[model samples]
Target: MPVATFSLVALDCPDPEALAGFYAGLLGGEVQKYNDIWCDLRTPDGIRIGFQRAPGLRPPSWPRADDNAQQLHLDLTVSDMEAAQERALALGARPLDLDDDGGERNFRVYADPAGHPFCLCRT
Candidate 1:
């Protein structure tokens, strides 16, 4: 039997509201701010993602195995890869790795405003 149920994933960011806003834009969620140091987004699909303020927190480096690396990332699936890519960029997502093996690969990597890496996967 399971010991505990799944809960939200909280990310450490410089600004909780700003980071939550970025995810809210990309994921179509409602941002709820409890305070200046904490905020969370409830997605349409019912996933809760929390953003907590972490002053002086350094964003992880992508594709690295060193001390600072991509500790975790989110994968979002989209029906239209091109459109999703454009939308993500418009919402302040920086392209980390868009080389999808000449359109054969099904996923592309990007970094949110706070530099958290996420992937827009083709469905």
Candidate 2:
């Protein structure tokens, strides 16, 4: 048996509530505010993602490995890539590489309002 249990994945962002809200909107979760410095989203899948406030936080330079690397990113699987992309965009997710082989690719990249890079993958 494992000695340690898996807890939650915490993300560093400028605004915890905003980031938590963004994730909640995309992932079908309930947002719980622990405080101004911390917030969490508990998804239907039982995954808990935590967002912490970092006043001077800077977003990663995604798809670029030099200077500022992409520390981490989330890959969200969707039933319809096109519709998901539309929804994400409407939710303040800025498109990074949309014309990536014109749907030939398995995933499309984007940056959240907080500037963290995430991918929308076809399920």
Candidate 3:
């Protein structure tokens, strides 16, 4: 028998509940109770997003602090860059000082609540 194929991405956060909530809202998914120390999000495509509570989670400093590197970044495609930026900012995404040179007419970058870098690109 072949091993079942699955894609599981784990994110370390200070609060699993809060992080799960953020992703649930952003991805339009359902948050399923997993256990005391972790939470799982069931995506529409069956992908599992796992969040583990790390009391001392130190977020990466992207576009700055050359040493600390971002583990992973989610690229989101949207219709409007400005609108998407506003929404993401409202959802706890912080702006980083990256040189877009105002050249990214179709994309912008931001950091998540946990300071993970992600981009919103024009579809």
Candidate 4:
């Protein structure tokens, strides 16, 4: 039998370096060049976040009245929701849902620079 463990989460981006930098800052990670077409971040937890170049990549549309279905998204945990949201917005993230009254302090959804959905959850 063979055992497997999660190693990395890779996302397709038009510019690997730009996306890599965004994630690195968000996760407190360090970015490194994997190759000409790829870049990766060595996160504090040892998990890698990889970015692969896709010249014609189109970002997923989410949380809109006529939004295209999202393929996938990442959830991030933070202490202060407002502050985190502000920081993310400053970093090129846009708010997706304006009204989220979930019972529990789950998360707030936003889109990255390229319009890919991601979340900021209460930690």
RMSD of each: 0.8, 1.1, 2.8, 2.5
Assess each prediction's global lDDT (C-alpha) against the native.
Answer: 0.93, 0.90, 0.76, 0.82
The predicted structure with the larger TM-score, 1 or 4, is 1
**Model 2: per-residue lDDT, tens digit, 41-118?**
999999999999989987889787977789899999998988888889988999888865877788999999889999
Question: Can you write out model 4's per-residue Cα lDDT over 1-123, one digit (the tens) per residue?
Answer: 659978888888888888888877788779999787999998898879888898888788775434556878999888888888888888788888745585264788888877779999887
* Displacement of the residue 3 alpha carbon in candidate 3, Å: 6.4
lDDT of 1 by residue, 21-123 (tens): 8888888979999999999899999999999999998889998868888899999999999999999999999999999998899999999998999999988
> Clashing residue pairs, candidate 2?
none
lDDT of 4 at 37: 97
lDDT of 3 at 72: 79
List candidate 2 segments past 4 Å from native.
none
- In order of appearance, the predictions have TM-scores of 0.97, 0.94, 0.80, 0.86
Better of 1 and 2 by lDDT: 1
Residue clash pairs of candidate 3:
none
User: Which 10-residue window in model 1 sums to the lowest lDDT?
Assistant: 62-71
